[model samples]
Target: MRAADRPADLRRDLVVSGEIHYFRLDPAEWADRLDTAVRTGVTAVATYVPWLVHELPDGTFDFGQRHPHLDLVRFLDLCAERGLSVIARPGPFVMAELKNEGLGYSVLRRNPEIRAAGWDGERRPETIVDYLHPAFLAAVDTWFDAVIPLLAAHAVDRGGPIVGIQLDNEIGMLPWVTNRPDLSDRTVAEFVEGLVATTSREAVQARYGVGATSFDVTDPATWGPALRSPVDEQVLALHRDLGRFTRDRYARYVQHLRAGVRARGVGEDVALLVNIHGCWGERATMFPLGISQLHRTWADGDTIPGTDIYIGDLDLDTLPGLWTSTAFLAATCRADQPYGVLEFEVGSGDYGEALDVTTGPEAAGLKLQLAIAQGGSLVNYYLLAGGRNPELFEPVGDGNDRIAFTGERHGFAAPIRPEGDLATWFAETVHLTEAVTDAAELLRAARPERPPVTIGFVVDHYMTEYRYPGSTREAEFVAELERFRGSGPREIMTRALVVGGYAPDATLLDGPDALADLPTDRVLALAPTPSLDDDLQRALADWVRRGGRLLLSGPVPQHDMEGRPATALIDALGLDVGPTHAATPGRTPFVAPSITPDGPAWQGAEVAVGFAQPLTTRRADAGTAPLAHLARTGEPCVLDIGLGAGRVVVAAADLPCLPQIWDALLARLGAHPRIRITSDSRGVVVVPCRTPDDVEVVHVINVSPWDTAVALERDGRPVTDEPIALARRSGTWLVRRSGETRARVAYRPPRG
Candidate 1:
């Protein structure tokens, strides 16, 4: 085939795909199902190959010898004949509500060591197997030996329809509860070794006032919340390090799976896709479970980690968070790779109770459009065609038959229903797929442009939410090391910025490389913690020196990641953080501060909710200016200091709680919003994207219950002089102009 016409090249463009389970449906319906998929403008289809279903009790495997429904090879052949590519998810643990998460019952039952253990060295609530366990890997090796050869033969390079291989679904989700650094013997050994290697015996003695011989990694109590008390800084450091250690294990598991797939002759050209569950703004802070720290895990070039967004319903509060999350997902992945929403909300799902709202066609269409605008080049609905769960039979006896874990005919609101008929959402699905197909060229080259303002997403701060839930204030602070910066500031900044008519990018601050990834012209909203790493501290100092405006929240870093006193950035900026102060208790009102008119705009604005004993910084530079002060104490709350070509704004109070203050800071930095939405309606979002032909297209999404009057602007000029009424829970593509001239533009709804 010609290079341009090759299937591999075609995979790079914007494509619509949906999950279809051949194993769950009758073989007679396969042809009709494939036909329906094509009519929906789907270039690809995806399915999970469950190991539990394929393997029999007698140590023998069935490749559709008895039942055609179990015929994966035949299904791939049908897709190839229909000209639809495939995304095959062959999991030893596919947690699609399957019993034992699709693992062969005998596998875990025979080897208890492979099972994930909880805090007390007991089995977790779910039957999730540890990925790196040697015996479990051995079992996977056996399964891959049989299954991968069949999958490899159907890959596009080998002239078949398979174009992608999903490497395990939602890694780290199994044991995401509190005390979750699986206390398996192997895990404990690794954790202790990591701590001893990175930290010194002298450092440990200084913090704990004890010898290194007293350290114990195997004791579950040592890892509990008691160790986090402010007095026990040494244990707090160890606790935080354990979270890091667990993160490494998750990344290595991906590497192992990718290696296993490649070793079986699966070509490199086929995409390696992994998915993360729930990393949507404030919702992502529900960490250790639905969400995980994506920075350390998805580093391999062959692998592309996509976010799994299942917004049951669209509300005003959910819209911006979703928008922020999708942008965060795009930023998390490599810039060049096509952004993906591997499992978007196709319809209402059930988790014993109805997990989603009644998502009609309007809500469905708007969700897809917003995803595309946020940089989703590849979109896959979780269940394109809903179907009945298969009744399993074991050779051992009738008692061994497993009931359907997700209930019979699980998807009641899927785009395609269980009876080979279209659901209410079918029309919208068709429209979106067709639109994506028509605009593939434009969508392929378009990426989410970096906003002029951004709030840094420090992973270490967010990942530590699972610690010290019930500990006293002092203990919790000590247990988390000096780095107890939680999601409060990060969440507030994102929400406040959106409310202030600015959509800020979430630039990660995990390592030095993250600094280079940021757009230098942008303003960074950073709430520094005492536990900032030495490398990150230097990077932030360099950013301010390079003329970037740094917005500070809580306290400047007085210590490094290990709780060791280190302040390279603090010294560079010529500021010293003084003693901490806390508000008087018994009243919810934290701080009521008044902004000074002498500073930036938004002065005289009211500030509610005082910060938690934040440090007061003593400025060493004569040029340092105070912008705002606490109403009660008359102490400076907002301070600005000039550093080299740029400037830094440090707020003694939490910046997020003060929106008007953020508005002033943004205005002072001279940051202009790319697009502004003027609407009283909640959950109305505007996403601007540039097509390959340089056409400016804005995706307007109204997720509210009522119709909203929305207007768009570019460089302060309104695309339309008057506001357009967006229907309730609907979406549309608004094109600014048709031709090359950037002059006087005429508006028109995009052709679907």
Candidate 2:
């Protein structure tokens, strides 16, 4: 491919990257994963700098400072040998399910005050070290003081392979997926400093046109209460003011860490990134508008300008919601640095140490994540080759507090076993890395724009419900909403727009000012809550009258609880009626047994569409237009009709909130261009290097002593043998075509 056709270089973007834990996999295997990484075309490697492991207890520090297995220096040497880059995670509290919050037993038992506080003023037993606490900083300082210097020297800038340093693991509870406990006097103090420095009650206000005098002049504690949501809501809004407070303050802490890494000499060349809990996307918060307070800290920081990448810990393989969530983060960057998937799921292995079952080898999740992650700079996977988490070294607490010995919540289902079992999952990862890294030059340059579909949605808000039990009232509803989450909203919008024969891809970011070349009267059915902004509202109004079509499943809302009417826009569309309630409550059969819409929009996927009782409407004009209604006992609860030259679709029920309904509705929206690849849910997929001359030189396997080959696809064309490797033990094979393009690979099952 030519230069322009080649994708942008996402930080060493290779699919075959592996995860190596600090406390796990014998250091001896370090060379093995590295060699496998190279043969697999893995350009980068990721490892967590477990605070608990290095610090052992407070005041003490260790590296290979004692054991060669613990040797940090030699590890980088291996990375350099293989021309691999590194992503380091040093968490004062890296909760990879370590005992005592990843802090060696000493920190937890000795530094009780550092733990976060609950609403009751007692320290939460689950966490260790208040994120912003000074003592915590001092403790981390003791660790960084010893190791960061070594990392700084090995950073890519210094001709070594270390490229990115992750600060803290995942601040948000994530995946199965905290409290903003500012109860610590230190947090309160830092909150004051941050407000004074970045806010504006005079000193506090800058962009939003608000102002506060001194930091103390404003009651910051009140800010927390304003953001309170139901316990079921896993996320809280990081609105501008509060967002600034939380973000800027958190930025201060990151800055401290960044500086320490820099002082050690890692400098600006080694990028610094913060990982957000992917579940944060479920929080229902808007971007720049509703990013959680904790996320905004890194998401909106200017401390380290060039280091503009913000990440999230999402194993997006099976969960479609996380795909768009990661994509959205890339969109929010001021500098538009590449979006990075800090912790892509490698496999469905263990949830917690207790769950000893493995997820799968095709790593079905990585397939889609890379599609989005490729939009930016880098995508890294953790525990690329997990062995055992170091022996709890020096038992820390209530013997029950062990992450390693217990395994994941389901079981110890890692791609590679702690006992060094090399499953097919590991082989697949190696194969994927080889394909991606070999073509890194070209693949890195390709930028696949989201297809021209108008059926996409943003990912945010609603994490709490998925991670744990939600409020009794909304739990079930919440769970259902996430059903079709893995399928992206953008994809839905694009596909519908495309199949409908519209050029939505060219003018999707429409309305008015966004792109004037587009027509003004195009309407889209927006599934929104009261959170829609005034600007978007105004834009929608202008476009509708100018001939845009809008099919609101509900009404063009005119007011919020504050009773403020967003009149200018709502009045123009003239949708002033309230909803028609469903009769018979839960028994309402709104879902039609077999309802179908015109064209490809409703193609594929199974959805239930029910008939409804017709309801009354004032400005209803129906002729030659499509009408879709969902109702109760023949009474119309959802009504779709045209208003002026535009359309208005309303539903009394928020069933579309359910994953099933949402996906079906999206299908009817339209179809887009996509190349489907079948993959297993091993978490991480494999990529391999190939040339016309070496098309038949790869192999892969699944489980019980087997092997196979991964294929390669380019601009809708394939160019090599499918990739292949070994299982928990090992295996091998040869390619078929030595110089032909191959789009997809089909691996065989291992012989029992």
Candidate 3:
């Protein structure tokens, strides 16, 4: 659905909700816990309707007839009485640490043939089922028949508390997390059928090389030379095809479920959401993998896409990854679809009881503000209230005694403990929620300020999920993938730009017309690799010819995505580039900065360490000027080439994250930061959002672990004369009106 065509109630807006498992909590205390959530300033509450908890031993279901905790209707009534909306998550496969991933044990036992198998033709260790298998879909249809009707009756259109219905819980999460894509017989047959239908049978055979017909095309082996260094072109091609096929299958599965739910009385009035899962712990490097895997699921703009962010803190090391993740998500989304966070990290990080560290209250505050600053309109804190995991109706001797794997009392680190008492972080949660609630109107109408630079997002770079388990060459494969298809270069470049005081926008480069749509006034930066899409390479060349400033880092494209030699970009711009190589063991690799007479005095040598490998660029045309050269070798590793009406800066070296280097490079392209911070701390991030009426909200965040005072500027004008003092790991918004001379601070954390 288009943005203009959306129903009034389904319009994108600020929704601050918290996840509260009603089935896990005692039914008697449901009112109190929900009252606490309302007191915390959340407008709504989200809960996963675990099928495992509501299903009976027989083929029937139980809606509190046998157990009080399973009374979903009662919980909805309580929410409506309190004037609180609900986001019901009835998952056919809810991976909330539940055995069989929240599916009915009886269903799985009865349909054992539906289980997903690995490359070895054996059932995978996890209880994940083949998503498209007939038996599995049939089971899901049965489960949805029991759940969707009840949810529809409680939907907002019916004067009930239900505002949104999540189609499924993190589709393809288990397979990706386990590195075991379903290779079951039925799945493989369907994949082959899809391959033949999408591309011709002849093309499939030609790509696989060994296949004479579509049926002969088998999946690549999980071991041996397929995953080793110098991988065969046929094997690599098949892997890419398999990745595409898996993503297509996931999209089709979601489409099927969406149709099912809509057919069962759910309609456009209630928002449909899809939770995307990829990031884990403190690193968001692989987050884009989820985006690529599920891009097709929501590309039609029917359902809203929300990422499941589990990143703990916003430090220098992790901040860039989160920025990349948010930017990439925005880049891939349609203009009408606004993204959000389905599982926003809150409380503590000790889910396993092994990690004795607690996530600071400031962490959630910073993350929430960051999400808002990046155009996020919806957020649901994963666990706001802890509760007990109810026992299963029938246990099958599986070590897990309760419905979930996280022991009896789950979510011990939540703001409200299992016993109905408030945790230490409860007050801070209230403060942050109130702050957002107060600024809801301003945030809903505001859009982030457009930056002068655009970062190219290549979805294929994140399609590195086909790792062979237990292979001796696994480390080598991972290293190679990191160099070619990982987020290493993207991370370094984003870190440099943000630290250099420039917030850049991202655009997906995989689309056919993406490069044509990019603004020529802004500089376009991309982390190019040898195996870039051939079409994209040609488009980049054309983009440069059309007066678009280009910044190409990492390796210059030498081969197409199919592993065939193709150099449209290199050939378009007169350049001679070679393969990238790591620095010699004990020797430091450095690039001497360019010192042109007429240009800005770009001082300091940029060094490459650890995983920052330097690519070799031998020569360029006479029109090219050397921007930076390899330090002792004196070979030009960074060159400024003037092509047609545009200019391109090719930095073959993946330099370390240095603000000075990025500032100097951007200065060469006439790109200056719109927002700047003058502070003692280097970890400060300044983000600005504005409404059409010229009301601006500047989000000043200090990601450092130490307190600091900061002064900000926008478009080269001082925001305020008085410096804003920010405590460690805190952020605040500076609201500026068009007529107002001074800016007012909002959501500023109290100083210790």
Candidate 4:
């Protein structure tokens, strides 16, 4: 590919890169590290140019004049000479465990007014600055003026190696993680302006019950001791409005940086990337929160959004979360927008040096396979090689003397140790990268096969970020939302479907045309809370009337998000919503399918209800049939109602992770898995992808801890007569050529 066409061209191919911090590594070891990255079959290298490291105490910049390790230009040239492309990340807030989050200390220390303040009107404990504050943006502009020119000169368009530029590292991460929204005066002003622009000034005043002007619209004090006794609709509305404003502010900050860099010689041909942060410690229950927070930044298709995946090892428990996270990322993107992993975790999970957490050697390879299987085209292994942390230009005398807070030697658990020795996982990394390179063409051409079901992704459901510090009402509200959004639907429902051999896609309901392109042949499953938006309720009713099959779990929505009456879906199904009952200590609630001798065989099977809260509803018309009933009372917990040309199955009870139950439920909606695993083990997952030319490949992953033989079939026809022996935590891709099956080992655990 031509240098000018590198960014766009790289997207077409499976671009596997590794992050190597040149500033952290010794100048003498640059060549060796570059060669080591090349040996791993990586096509490019990514590094963060920390503004804290290069900026001098006098506000001037130093590019290797003061320290040899700070020579970014020399490192870029070396990477280019070694035939490796580059991805430059110059961050005004690169949170690589650095003080002030990679910003110069003088910047924050001298201008404390730019610091972000929380709902308490106090500065946040973290050094998170107001992203769009005038002072902070001015400093960012100065930093960009100094760094973008250097990066632009080395960019692919200038016959250099830089292929992409990451705008800011993990935008809106600190605020979310710290639960501290920027409630500074400037931010509040901007929020009021946004509210007025979107709605009217009168609307803002009426909503907040404030003075006649937008200036009187003050930030709601949701936190601290001043919180209201019973949190009312006004507080919830303000919180939601603030969340929306924050997302818009983050997007504007990115756009401002993008414009600044473009003006400073960075061409439009260079791919601009954003690192989305949400998942942490391998748990992906709240991963969609990051997408919701930063959706405005990348939803326009102008910029590419990459998820920072820190999911350690792939197991049956973690597989569903990873798959859902990856699938959701893909679903949120435009058809032409390519998404990838920005910080693909590698090595041990000992960031704090106290957890004693160790990632298995085979973890990286398995994650790579799963990511690719779920439509990831690019992979950047974070800390592919380790290095020593350089001394800060001006030390603050805060304990350890290093630029980063991680200590003297950084990335000690990486595949390449800080001392330049290969770690235990190096060989596995090499194998996985080589395998991807071998099948680059096929993988690039293939796309995930369309599944028979599409799960509804409700962005507002995850707007549970703001909370009163110790308010019981706030705690209960958050728990309730988490149950419906995180635990019940995301964790249980998603896992049950995937493990049951069903590949389901996701559709973001926040979009204006959410159901416009929804396939009528597929079942649309949603986990609704007690309340849903009025517009969405109507849209879903119309969709069902237009012949779209619907499956709903949890309670029937009787009100909108603000707790106002809105029951279009319930009314359409001819059902009366009833009270929800929780399982008590002694009298445990259970649900069982109603026995029908002539019904499907699965209807006779009993559902194992383990701690599931069941909601009771009554049929108001003859069109509704009781599929399941609460064992405690005989009230219908699961109902199948027929609409004009479609059907709606209301599963009022939160189902557990039972494959048989999910299979039976989906079967009722005329949905079946294309790929089936007829194995006793439920740990194996099958994902099928097909190229444009009709070439088919199936990815069989065994996420269990023990070896198992899996029998796979496609459309009820067996692919192979003999069972395929898969080692523990291993996966393989089988390609069908004519009448023969060829196996490409993606990752296999080393045998004893």
Count of clashing residue pairs in every prediction: 10, 149, 0, 0
Q: Model 4, residue 752: displacement in angstroms? A: 4.9
List the pairs of residues colliding in candidate 4: none
Native RMSD of candidate 4 (Å): 3.3
Model 3 stretches with alpha carbons more than 4 Å out: 1-10, 211-233, 469-478, 483-487, 579-581, 599-601, 605-622
lDDT of 2 by residue, 79-101 (tens): 76666667777776676656655
Residue by residue across 170-206, what tens digits does model 1's lDDT show? Answer: 7766655334546666666565555656776555335
lDDT of 4 at 42: 83
Which candidate's lDDT is highest? 3
Ranked by TM-score, the better of candidates 1 and 2 is 1
Whole-model lDDT values for every prediction: 0.66, 0.45, 0.78, 0.77
Task: Provide the TM-score for each candidate, comma-separated.
Answer: 0.86, 0.66, 0.93, 0.93
The Cα error of candidate 2 at residue 172, in Å, is 3.5
Clash pairs for candidate 1: 228-475, 228-479, 229-475, 230-474, 230-475, 316-683, 581-613, 590-610, 591-609, 591-610
Ten residues in a row with the worst lDDT in model 4? 222-231
